[model samples]
Target: MSIRARLLSTIAGQLGNPHGTLGKGVAFMLNRSNHRAIAGAVEATGVTAGATVADIGFGGGAGLSLLLERVGANGSVHGFEISPDMLSRARSRFAGEIGTGRLQLAEGPMTGLPLADNALDAAITVNTMYFVPNLDAACTELVRIVRTGGSLVVGIGDPDAMAKMPFTAYGFTLRPVAEVIAALERAGCTVDHQQLANPPIPHHLLVARPA
Candidate 1:
């Protein structure tokens, strides 16, 4: 492969799941860049105290911490991450919460979340959909896990803008906003809210509830 192709492939791999030393570096970058989107996703969930929620692809645990705060001391937060490096970082960062039984981090993919049916009051995933191989299956899993009346929020960068990013030319599935909403609706979720964040590369947050 060309040097540029190889570089993009490496970056795509890291984004999918950070691994060793290099993975750690990539995880740090992702945590920094995804902050606003993560915050927007957590807020979009509208979770409250005592609510049980999960943060899908909780890179570096930053968003997980935010979700924990929103759910308060009485609630629980579950983190789903496929990347070993990211998962390790999250476990270390939230050690206190794990020890106290308020948080659990599981290593797994979104297609088959290691959670029970109707087990969550809400769920949120930020900037992770582009990496999922089967978007429909992932959406179905979300519907299966979140109970009726429960909410789900997914955040992603605008595809048009993201497409302009050089790295996205490699192995990225930049779905249109309408397609995403349609997939969620077909999965039995009712689209409830939508928002676009501030700035040049505005992020999109879509909130839905089980139909």
Candidate 2:
């Protein structure tokens, strides 16, 4: 493979499941760059005390702590991560919350979240949609898990901006904003908000609610 192709492949591989030292380093950088977007997604969920929420791609757990705070003593937050390195780091960081039964972390695929159907009050995912093997299936899965009238917040960098990145040429799917909103609507969600920003990196935040 050409050097460029090889680099893209390596990035895609690490994102799919970061595992070792390199993965750890990448996770750290991801956590930093993704912090604001993650917070925005979680805020869009409008999570509250006594609410049951889930973080679909809870990488490095940047938003986990904030989610836990919003959930308070009466609520619960579940984190589903595909990366082992991320899962381990999250589990370690939130051990106290986990012990208190306020936070639960697991290694699971987004297409088949390990939770009861219609079990969540809200769900959020930041910078994860690009890596999903099937966007439609992933949307169906998320819609199935979130209860009726529940919120689903998905945060992503602007496709136009992300496309400027090299990995997108390899495996990342630069889904159009319109296409994503349509897919969520098809999955029975009513798009409530669509926020966009361009600085540092372009960002898009979509907030939807199940019908």
Candidate 3:
């Protein structure tokens, strides 16, 4: 690969599967940059105290804290992540909650969340869709994990806006907003769409429930 191509691949790989010190740095940046979108996703999940919720692909764990708070002390928050580095960071960062059994983090892909069917009251995944190789299978898994009458909030950067970024051309698989909604619908979920008011890069949140 060309030097520039290699560099862009490295950056995108870090975003997709953070590793080492540089990956940790990228995770920190993602935590900050994705803050607004994560907040909106957590809200859309409609989690209540004492409920069980999961943050699928909880990159940098920005949404994990929010989900924990939404579920409160009596509730449970589980996190599934593809990156072991990110999972280790969360294990250290949320040790108190882990010790108290209020938070759980596991290393796994979204397509195979290791949880039983209807294991969650609500679930949300923020800013992690582009790396997923199989959207249809991932959507099916999301439907399987969340209970009937429960909610699933998926947040992603706008494809048009993401396309404008030079680095995204490397490893990102930016999908159209409509294609994502259709994937969820095919997975047996009724979907709703919302756009956050973030500037520069628009963020889309898809709220889905079992139809």
Candidate 4:
């Protein structure tokens, strides 16, 4: 395998197999300040205790689990992952929730969500926008699935920080935050909140409401 594939495999393995020997360490590391910042950004989008939610690119299922906790049993959480390996890992990690019907793991891109229009209360994506080749289409899909007044929160590494990272080696492009926000606005979403957080990594969070 190539170096990029190997690196991603290592990261995914560490995250997906939380019951594996490395799972505890990975979980612990995720609960630290940096991950907390990402989680907080998602929460700031206004997900409530009984809101149906979707977490796009739910790597290792960490953010999905966090969202589930916020929404509790009254709500349902759906996780969309394009990576087969990552989805497998997430399924294993949240087996209980999946089995009980509280969480749904869908294997596909957010561009073609298997959901009805205005079906969700909130949706969040973290550190995954860089992989989307078409920002406008993705934003439209996000807004289409969420109800009016629903929230769509997207978190991505700051372009400047991503430009300096090793992510380029893994095929990640550093997309400008302004471009993302503009695309969302053009797609008919009202800009509700935008902020940058500097922690484990420098990232930008954009929250919008369906118009």
Best by lDDT: 3
Q: Give the TM-score of candidate 2.
A: 0.94
Model 1 Cα RMSD, 1 decimal:
1.3
- Give the lDDT of residue 56 in candidate 3: 88
- Can you write out model 4's per-residue Cα lDDT over 134-188, one digit (the tens) per residue? 8899999989999998888887777887676553545565777889999899988
Range of the 10 consecutive residues with the lowest summed lDDT in candidate 3: 196-205
Error of 2 at 26 (Å): 1.2
TM-scores, all candidates, are 0.95, 0.94, 0.97, 0.83
User: How displaced is residue 59 in candidate 1, in Å?
Assistant: 1.4
| Global local distance difference test of model 3 | 0.91
Q: Pick the candidate with the highest TM-score.
A: 3
Q: Which stretches of candidate 2 lie over 4 Å from their true place?
A: none
Q: After superposition, how far is residue 11 of candidate 4 from its true place, in Å?
A: 8.3
Residue-level lDDT tens digits of model 1 in 1-211: 8999899888887777778989878877877888777888888888889999999888767788899999999999999988877888888888999999999999889899988899999999988899977889999998889989999998888998999887887778999988888889999988965666653378888898996
* Ranking of models by TM-score: 3, 1, 2, 4
lDDT of 3 by residue, 20-129 (tens): 98978998998888899999999998889999999988889988999899999999999998888899999999999999999988988888888999999999998788
By lDDT rank, best first, the candidates go: 3, 1, 2, 4
